[model samples]
Target: MTDASDRLASVRAGLDRACRDAGRAETPLLVAISKTFDADAIRPLIAAGQRHFGENRVQEAQGKWPELLAETPEITLHLVGQLQSNKAADAVALFDVIHSVDRPSLVAALAKAQAAVGKRPVCYLQVNIGDEAQKGGCALADLPALLDQARTAGLNIVGLMCVPPADVEPAPYFALLAEHAKRLGLAGLSMGMSSDYETAALLGSTVVRVGSALFGSRA
Candidate 1:
């Protein structure tokens, strides 16, 4: 079998076991992050039935995915990076799920874009769970109000997303994110990555973004 297929099987098995352990009846969607990887590298996973894919940059995604997407219409593209307001229209047109709705300005921009395009991609509010300065997420203190703003702006805020501070144990942060989502009446938690997806799944991550584990080292 192909390397991508082997890796995909391994990750799927791990996710299944994690869900069983957590007693979660629903399985988390595994988004194979193909940010730096090109279409040639991603085609194998698609051939192996990987429907969900993630990209970090809109320009890079535009550069490649259109042709690939025309070939496989079932593929779901997820924008798993910081989104600029100016790119909201392109983002709305290209992606199926956006995991970084962090601020009111962005919410308004996305709302306007969705209205103009008549396509509303599922959005998740990115929460700076660790309060890190370099991350692109709303402050924990600002999340409640941000949710209100997003709802008021007519964006479909399905859930919350976060990247915990790097190099630290992510369990606490994942748990905190789950609790935060639960408290806000949000159902989806877009947490976890190559290093700690199991923990995130056990804690209730509805969508896990995994990159290197599926595509090997990125360029």
Candidate 2:
């Protein structure tokens, strides 16, 4: 088994190579997806110079945040999954960036929670580029209204996020997100994952939330 240090080094090398291939800068922020692993596994990665991490479940993040922050105060936590409106307050309290703000209700909840917490939470409006009804994202046609609502609610709408259909090439989906960001005049696009990040970079993703590629397969 690869040790944490070895795994991190290898992942960095791969990221560097991918950036070069995509003709992007070499220092793109890498958010280590630490959803499944416990603190013991995560500590080594933090020690290995990883400062950004992502989680999928609000409940899981709630359990991990304090311990991880206590051990490494500089780590940035991103909530990268479907966020329930009920958990919005907790998510606001714990995460630095909420990358899956998919619905108007959730956006309103996050805005209220941010105000209650007295901290502005950076958010990404998730777009369902593939238009998969089962997925958790705002319909493409509704993005303008959603963005307008978020602005009125005083949430800092920083960028856009999306997950492509698993079976197809992720480039088109990534391109669609970039186009949406351009249309909205947003500065960030949190797209890509373990399998298709290179394509994402080529398509102008400012942030790539990668797992498995960094931490190995989740259990």
TM-score of 1: 0.98
Clashing pairs in 1: none
Residue pairs in steric clash, candidate 2? Answer: none
Angstrom error at residue 201, model 2:
1.5
User: What does candidate 1's lDDT look like per residue over 1-219, in tens digits?
Assistant: 389899999999999999999998988999999998899999999999999999999999999999999999999999999999999999999999999999889999999999999998999999999998888999988999999999998888899999999899999999999898999999999999999999999999999999999999976
Task: In model 1, state the lDDT of residue 57.
Answer: 91
lDDT of 2 by residue, 1-219 (tens): 247778777766766777788778744567889999888878878888889999999899888779879878888899999999999989998999888988889978998898898888788999988999899898889999999999999988999999999989888788888888899999898988888776777677788887887777877
196, model 1: CA deviation in Å? 0.7
- Listed in order, each prediction's TM-score against the native is 0.98, 0.94
For candidate 2, what is the lDDT? Answer: 0.85
